[model samples]
Target: MSTVEPTATKRFSFMDILKAPLLIAIALIIALLLLGEYLSPGFASGQQILRLLIVAALMGIVAAGQNLVILGGREGIDLSVGGVVSLAAIIAGNLMGGENSGIVLAILGCLAAGAIVGAINGIGVTLLRIPPLVMTLGMLGVLQGLLVVIRNGIPSGRAAPGLSQFVTQPVFLGLPGIIWLWIVIGLAMAFLLGRTMLGYRIYAIGSNEQAAFMAGMPVKTTRILLFVLSGMFAAIAGICLLGYTGSSFANVGEQYMLPSIIAVVFGGTALSGGKGGYTGTMAGATLLTVLQSILTTVNIDESGRQMVFGATLLLLMLFYGRGKALRA
Candidate 1:
């Protein structure tokens, strides 16, 4: 008997995986204010870059969770992510009280609360026969309602003394601590996705779920696990928000949902699932943050900001969406 070689299928190169629209978005962002230097000198300064990092670090953490679920396939998307963040913050605030003594319990409580909420999302999608979009959206509203009820329209609890200091203070190297944290998260997630079998399964499932199931991948279990991990990441974001602001608020996580989705999508992760990485998501997050900073420095009003943001998203979808369709 002769041994035979296994044939390999063609895969997209890393650069090939990145679509043209993403490149355009990046270029547009870079040159958005080049023509206006006379009107606003030093518009893109080192200080501005640092501010972008600070904002991206906060938004990217939540995007990290969305990255995992979207990459896991099965029409998977978490609409409840913002809700989880908001509710977790509220829970942490209520449990932590104003006293420094309650800090440990509050942190633990936040983690548990996030996990529970994520589990509900997982169950609804996987076991209850609800589409992920519908299930997560419903949960989002429910979670928001609960947060309002719990906090009674007021933000509850001040963050722990040490956490507030840690987030706001520059590290020994003079960069904000949150930036360092984001770096660490990027590295860790990269390692996890590359080194573990779990990571392979996630990619496999996203690429082709029925085939993955036929290949004996633990489909449902993996979904639950992915959701749980997503919840954990969202909780961490809420915690970071609290530390950065020195207080917890009911609205803290409300702003995260779209940015998170946009970051992951813009990062080149397939919204339809499969074929993307933390590198893309991180870069996308950075670009979005920079765009916002530029807009603010130019004194774009609230309506203007919304208009630009929506327009950018629409362009990204038109271009990046093609790449995704091609991948499929």
Candidate 2:
């Protein structure tokens, strides 16, 4: 008899790797929609869903930046992102003053402010070897103080009318322009992380920094650029938020910090670094927004809602944590 040869099993494709979490997210979303419909017949209507997407878009934008930072490895994170958002909104609002003509300057100002903060963060982390957490936290305090001094603890400015109208006005398919903006931004981010040399270097450094350095990667430059990109993304999010709200405030970005981190982690990014993508973060953002809607519909008290949020986050962490261990 002829000897039988054993064939090697094929490794899973990238899409296959993504499908697990993506499917779970979709299922969870559907379940939530059903529950919402049961609790309130109109809860799952198209309009309601679109509203949820709008809110998700806001969080998604900020979370995208956090996602990038976390993906860069070496204890990377940006605690000051919330502060950046707040300052960006304030700057944009004041510069625009509800005037269409001021939109250009407003945008430039927001980006500049974000870039400056990001540069400082990059310098501190890459050059000084400061822990990212400590650096960003200190920066956060500084920004909070700066904003207070700038505004005298009183927020004073209206969002640009043109910007506000653009974000709020429904366009094709009954979706606001902001949603399209989110989609474009999401696509751009996906391309950046998956299709560019920069993306490859980011993952390489994240996976093993010493190895990446030995392989001739500009480790410091790449890390610093990651911070810069993160800051820019945060600024864009802040501007969109101001447009959505038609105004800006000192604490406007406060609620987003934790949510951004949660969304990034829940989307399956490893806290230790490396091995994740924007797709998971987007799904996480959607899930969070939907959960918020459910909590509101059920009239859950703030304390109860917080408890549920914490519990849910813990479960997600454990779930993904197990997956990570298994892969190891």
Candidate 3:
């Protein structure tokens, strides 16, 4: 009998880690589409899917920011994200006021404002020793108050005609400009998280703060950068909203708060932090947008839609909470 050589033992590859969330997202999208079609024969359409993609791109941008902060580890998170988005959208719109002439300055001012807010978050958590949850939650209140004072309960200004056109316009292969922007941001963020020393420090700090500090990492600077990154991304999401809606409303960013968290969770990013990437986040955003689109196509009322949204999030918690449980 010929002795059979022992088969080489297979080890888990990096590709396998990346594959799970993408597969899950695709499977869910397919299932949702079929279910939607069954419920409403007209529900599944290319146009509808494209629309969802645009929305997902916007949320994905926001989630990318949150992912950065959370990945810093140390139990970091940004509860103020909705407020930041809402406030930034209004501020950016007011600055631009649909004026082509003012667009450049407006963009600069909005980015600056976002950076300030992010810095505040970082300061509170790092210097004051405030927990991230409490600090960001406080920021949400402060920002909302600021937005309320700025608008005085009414959203003002239309997005610039040029900006609006660009947002909704198609680029190469007929994809929306927002989608292309997401691609650029995703590539940049992936590089920052994977290629740079900062990226290594983020994961290192997140995995174990004390260990990271011992290794000579600038923990404070890294933490601050994470919060600032969150603000920047949130502002970017707001910019997309401004373009998508053409006008700002007091509640323009109201729905995004929980959805942002849900997208990150759905992307397989643990709430407690330490492991995830923009790749999973992009998929998560797509899944969320598709879910919302499917519901709209089926003619779900506003209240019902909100109910479904909450329920879907709850289900995600149930399935994705395992990492949290394990960490605990």
Assess every candidate by TM-score: 0.86, 0.91, 0.89
Q: List pairs with backbone clashes in candidate 1.
A: none
Candidate 3 wrong stretches, greater than 4 Å: 1-17, 153-155, 300-304, 323-328
Worst 10 residues of 3 by lDDT: 4-13
Model 1: per-residue Cα lDDT over 98-118, one tens digit each: 667777887898889888888
How many Å off is the CA of 39 in candidate 3? Answer: 2.8
Alpha-carbon deviation at 123 in model 1, angstroms: 1.7
Q: Rank the candidates by TM-score, best first.
A: 2, 3, 1
Best by TM-score: 2
- Relative to the true structure, how large is the alpha-carbon lDDT of every model? 0.76, 0.83, 0.79
184-273: candidate 2 lDDT, tens digit per residue: 987887777777788778887887889889989999999998888888888998998999898887678888888998888767777677
Ranking by lDDT: 2, 3, 1
Winner of 1 and 2 under TM-score: 2
lDDT of 3 by residue, 104-131 (tens): 7667877788889999999989988899
